[model samples]
Target: MMAKYGACLLCLSASVVGSAQAESLAISALGNLDLSYTQPQRVASYEGSPLPAQVEILPGNDYWISTPENIQQVHFLVGQGQRVSKGQAIVKLTGPEVFHYLAQVEAAASLYQLAKSRYERNKPLLANGSISAEKWREISQDYFTTHLEYEHMQHFMERVHSTDAATDSLVVAAPVDGIVKLNAISGPYMAGDQLFSMVPNNSIRVKVNVPTGQSHSLSAININQCHIAIESLSAIAEGAFVTAWSSAVPQECNLLLGQQMTVVPEYQKAVYLLPKNSVFSWEQDSQVFTLSDNQLNALTVDILGSTPEQYIVASDQDLSQLQVLSQSVAAVKGIMLGLGGE
Candidate 1:
């Protein structure tokens, strides 16, 4: 069956080529091949098919809330997915570390007061030459050291919301306004253990990986058919791909953090779109036959992108103004290849 089909195609191609010089035979051959022409659609820009992308929390907008000390009992004040304000109490913690740090703050305060008083008392004595300069210097050093220690301890207590040290339990507050996410378990947690996560102001962005093969100017990109502003494109290519980031997405888009989806990328360039059947491969390059003055001429085209039934292409000649073979393309292409001694 295949050998007979090949012989028939060869005969048809030879007849078509042989009648090229005679208008009557050429017209009849063209009619028998069922050839028709179509003009390409021209556009300023074009978007390819959907490419994979991921929604990610913007850098610096993600906060990991952690415990400052070993916690025996952990209770979340805010529920998961709750919106919390800055400095709002988010967690209630109970542990021996809390009381231990509170006592340290009080002891540092007493030492600071004593050192400060001695420093003040020796100032006048040193001015009047009653106390040696070396003794006054020693007192001044003690005063500054004690003051720093007191401030350090005071700040630590304030961090855990136990500045007064009046309670055995400590309360930790949110560092910024954001949506809360729980990470802690029911059991006790060690120091620096992440208790929850916060996404500040819903600042999340979409990330796309553009292949290095794409060299045209990227004009726009859309997720779920919703246009998104491109925040940045990385200058350095990682392996075979370059990363691109979108601006903070709107809440209505309903994109979730770490969610992967399809994105359409459009390039800014004038190109022509033709039906997929109109194009054919010739000598390892894409080419289409254009009809002009009763003659069919092959023109090479640069394929930029494609759809299910159409191809986005570019050529040196303006394909928008010319008629290209749209039907019986394979038969005509085979004839052209036969004439070319292929």
Candidate 2:
């Protein structure tokens, strides 16, 4: 009787083990599993391109005005950040030398007048028989000589006067309508001092610096169609044109002058976007869980491209019949049951 009981207990234990295995399989089938669908998509990506270390917005043609005076007092017109127009005065310089040149000009003019009078008087005497031929010739030559000297003096005087006037009251005008970038105050400027810099309001360009290695990637895309974001200004601007670039990444985007910005270039082909979480890795290979017939199916996916937000995958088989999950599911055991049912 004890042996019979022992045998019966063994049979019951076996039955319980089998039932547990079946229950475990059923639970795995009922558990949630992540799923994703595949579709043929055109994906676009760019290689790492070198961009400018910094970007700036500078005047296309910077202006630097200086006082043309050896020693003079300088005065500023518009202060820094002041808006100026073309031909607007910026600064003035005055000195004693300015009046000195004016005096020379006046003296030269007076001498020229005297020489003209002498020439008129001698010409009539030379033509008439009043004076001896030799005397007449001498007077005429003297008058002509004096006249030439007077003319030379007059020219020299004019130049001196003009220069003096410029020095006495130097009016530095804006070459174009722009904002003053620099301020020149409290200065006795020499002939070549930069008193102010004017940046044109309309002359603005979008600049992007691509890395030497990544320059080829930029070439593959349309630069003119690229989008740009000005971080400081919080403004969005489109690419006007690509002015210049070099193999080396410049410290600053000189064309933009010095504005720092984020640039997104337009790609040649459309990109296929998938959720970032949908991708998985197996043996260092990228894949996605595809669902078919209420079951999860494993598929090795070729990652064509990727971005910060999504990934682009490529597959040889049609994935229209499959369902892809955008989010992660709790358990993947149900996927196995779904596969068995299919």
Candidate 3:
């Protein structure tokens, strides 16, 4: 706080202060105002509040790559923040779980082979009525299903497979290009837990949560109308407003996953948007000088808040048809002094 403005004002009042104050008062009285017209315009609004948000990596068709089952002594080929290309090995896992599944698949494969041989041998026998036709059909179906299950298991090994005949370590590869982003865990991640997270190329979106009181404003947002600015990045992220709730909206943006950032998301409003200079605050109240019936009328207004470009005003009077002075500062003081403009 300053010691006092009185000393400065007194020193200047005789010459400079008198001239400036007179000029201000004259301008207020003459009512020469910078006037502009406005419509609802989807309730002219802008976003200002820098809210907390995180950078999320959205996948193209398949988003995430997780572990197959419980595995121990896992090693990640890619480190956090490292860019990985498609077909690159991402992680390797070793544990009894892998061997157990491998054994089951091998057993299934052997059974499939035996069933196939038996079907070949019995196909003619059944045709000749040497064996039951039902038995032949069952044998063929068994061979087909077992072969399918075994083939699927083989494909699985391409992801997490034994290093050698002993099945020491299973290697998993990246399916697409992405930057590495891991989930929370210490060591030996279990089945269904994320071993490594990859933020696929061009798959970043943000989830913005607005205050519950501003639910109405949130709903008015859309892909075409909404935009996002991440302050941390010093850049603007154009968004596709894909999902919305009463108090939140998910917008598509380009950013790294799990990155904490501050975002300003543009949205629509239902109140009056005024120039900041138009509204003046008094003791416990706010007022705007509007030209009504060719007369200057000071209208009381509720200021929801200020945005980057406009002040959101809620006025009981219809301001859509009214012209408010953008230079209302002097006019406000003049009105207080009973020197109201004509």
**Model 1, 9: alpha-carbon shift in Å?**
31
lDDT of 1 by residue, 114-151 (tens): 99999988888988999888888899999999999999
Candidate 3: misplaced stretches above 4 Å? Answer: 1-45, 56-74, 93-137, 158-170, 179-204, 213-256, 269-277, 280-286, 297-304, 307-321, 325-342
Candidate 2 lDDT over residue span 150-173, tens digit each: 675554332221233545543446
Clash counts per candidate, in order, are 0, 20, 2
**Number of the top candidate by TM-score?**
1
- What TM-score fits each model? 0.66, 0.43, 0.54
Cα distance off (Å), candidate 1, residue 27: 11
Root-mean-square deviation of each candidate, in angstroms?
A: 9.8, 19.9, 11.9
Candidate topping lDDT: 1
